[model samples]
Target: MTFTGGNPQEEPPRRVAKKSKKRFLWLALVTLLALIAVVLSVLYDRGEFDGLRRRLLYTKAQKDENGCAQLYRYASDQSGSFASLDGSLVSVSMHQVSVLDETGKTVYEQTVKFQSPALVRGAFRAAAYDVGGTSVYVLTAKGLACQVDTSGEILAVALNKDGYLTVTSNESGCKAAVRVYDASGQPVFAYRSADRFIMTAALSDDSRTLAAVTMGQSSGVFTSYVVFYRINSESALTTTALTGSLIYDLIPMGSRFCAVMEEQLCFLDDSGEVRAAYSCGSDYLRRVDCGDGYAALLLGRYRNGTQHRLVTVDSDGQVMASLDVDGEVLSMSAAGRYIAVLFSDRMVIYDKTLAECARLDAVSEARQVLMRADGSAVLAGSTAASLYLP
Candidate 1:
């Protein structure tokens, strides 16, 4: 009678123990899953998966009948500059700078006063500074990377594709000073000139070479020179004498450099010797812009007329393409292998061969056109900016 049920009570206890074990295992599993989720969230917030996310989530923008998608609308200055950086829209105004993501979301905004604000874009970063002021800000797609307060007034600034910055300022003891900074805002190289004025300087794309345009006087005749230097040393690599109108732009194109002057476009090699020079030949240079390995020059027969020709020149100083522009060119931009030209009534996008890729009509509100590496263009208006997809 005492053990009559054949250990039925023992069976109940065994079943209870089995249920408890299963419950514990379920709790442990859930805890592990939660921890994994948290770690993934942190990584996402830190942008550790940005590249993968962008690739996996790539979606074509929904465009309207004008082949345009409104990116962002904000109160902005009419003369502000717009540039594309890492799939974000960077708008530089007189008193503020804003960055908007591809989804038309504001990612960063900073308020600063700038009398003559200018913006230049690299691959993933941008350099915004006052043309004649002391404040310089380096920005990325997320936010401001660094702010550089120079000891003197800022004259010109250049940002390479890798975010290397070159700032030419007016120092007290020298006619002009050129300072090069790495991506972290740390000064890596500095040179002060006492004999000639350094108009502007640019660091090569590889960050190994430096090119400076200097204006000097020889025999009471104004002379300009493209001086090349190694970033790690103080000695000049070579000096290519350029005697003519003032040099307006100096761009580093791989092993060579492209110098844009008032009257001609000169391409120089690493030895600082002119490889090829393209003269305007009766057509006056109206507007000039440099892209990846090519320069876009808008030349006109008359000083300020619609009878202009858009010319694309390669690093070898050869004309890659040319188009007769019959309309007034309001703004033009180049990136990768395409160029975007904004007219008073329309916008035209062309390939490197000057072939028409896409055109958007009735876009008179766009004040500027900024090309993306993917061939899309960002059209900036007075108070809003739109993305044009072809």
Candidate 2:
């Protein structure tokens, strides 16, 4: 016939070639899908997805003429009762703790009887506790993560970026005690001091090191000691004594710790030794806040009608920037690389170099400012809170 010229072996070779081409196409598609998966994983780890989701879900805050958008209006207008945590607003009243999203949606709410309600926020979590009381509630954006009931009164509480909690309490049989809990509310470490009373404690970001401030008197002189400990060890790793200044707070930044004192800001290494200290010269320290790798201090003269000085210091105690602010400063907040200063007549946002990035005038209702790491700010008013995006 007309097809008799074709060989049977030739037909078999053509079939094999088709099969090989199909296999190659399948392999190429699998490789492309694997690459896409890897890219998504990296983006998720860096919080890109979270940021995108927040932008999409919280689009209700429309900018007004002053670039200020009312993100949430509080149910109660109690001053010093609201905080910002992970793009959400946390309000702690005497009877309830509420967590609201950017669109003013209630994410979580609980009834609590706190004599003095206080909030400590981390990267993605916030802890609501009663100052000098026994109730402590650890929370996340989803809901209440855990509740810790200490054996004694809660003196001070610190939260790391990862939500690890360091609680200092006045426990029985000891002058003070420090307890560390993980983000999941599991107990990680505990220490009780009988010689010196622990004022406050901070857990390192890695959760492997714990640093606590202890107040004691040596030779009839008031002294403060920073005690370092390995969470796995029962003994103190190191102790560094600081004198002449009243230690106000202890904040752990990465591998080191920053001790906020009455007269100076001291940066301590992991061994509890002072790496650098920035002394507030003739100015009196009025307010201070610590961010990722820097500290902002508000210093002013004791006289009226004088401008206040705002200083920013790096983790190595190097002065990064200083700005002279005129007017009455109501509150100051630092987070990430930006600092938010709320004055009587206006609000100013400054970068790490103390350069004014944005300013909004006539903010008389704003009592406090909470700066976010994304250059946005939450202005806490007596009755409502608004978001300012620059």
RMSD of each: 11.1, 5.7
Q: List the residue pairs that clash in candidate 1.
A: none
Candidate 2 accuracy as TM-score: 0.84
TM-scores for every candidate against the unseen true structure: 0.83, 0.84
Per-residue accuracy of model 2 over 292-383 as CA lDDT, tens digit each: 68899988876565589989999888999988877888888888777999999999988778877788886888888999876778998876
Residue pairs of candidate 2 with colliding backbone atoms: none
Judge candidate 1 at residue 13 and give its lDDT.
Answer: 75
Give the clash count for model 2.
0
lDDT for each residue of candidate 1 in 1-390, tens digit (9 for 90 to 100): 564545876557767899999999999999999999998888654434433453444456666888678867878577588888877888887888888888888888888888999998777889888889998889888878988889999999998877899999999999999999999999999888888889999888889888999988778888898888888999889887888789988887877778888789998877788988888888999888777788888899888779989999988778998889889888988887778899998899887788887898968788889887667788889988888766
Clashes of 1: 0
**Location of the lowest summed lDDT over 10 successive residues in candidate 1:** 46-55
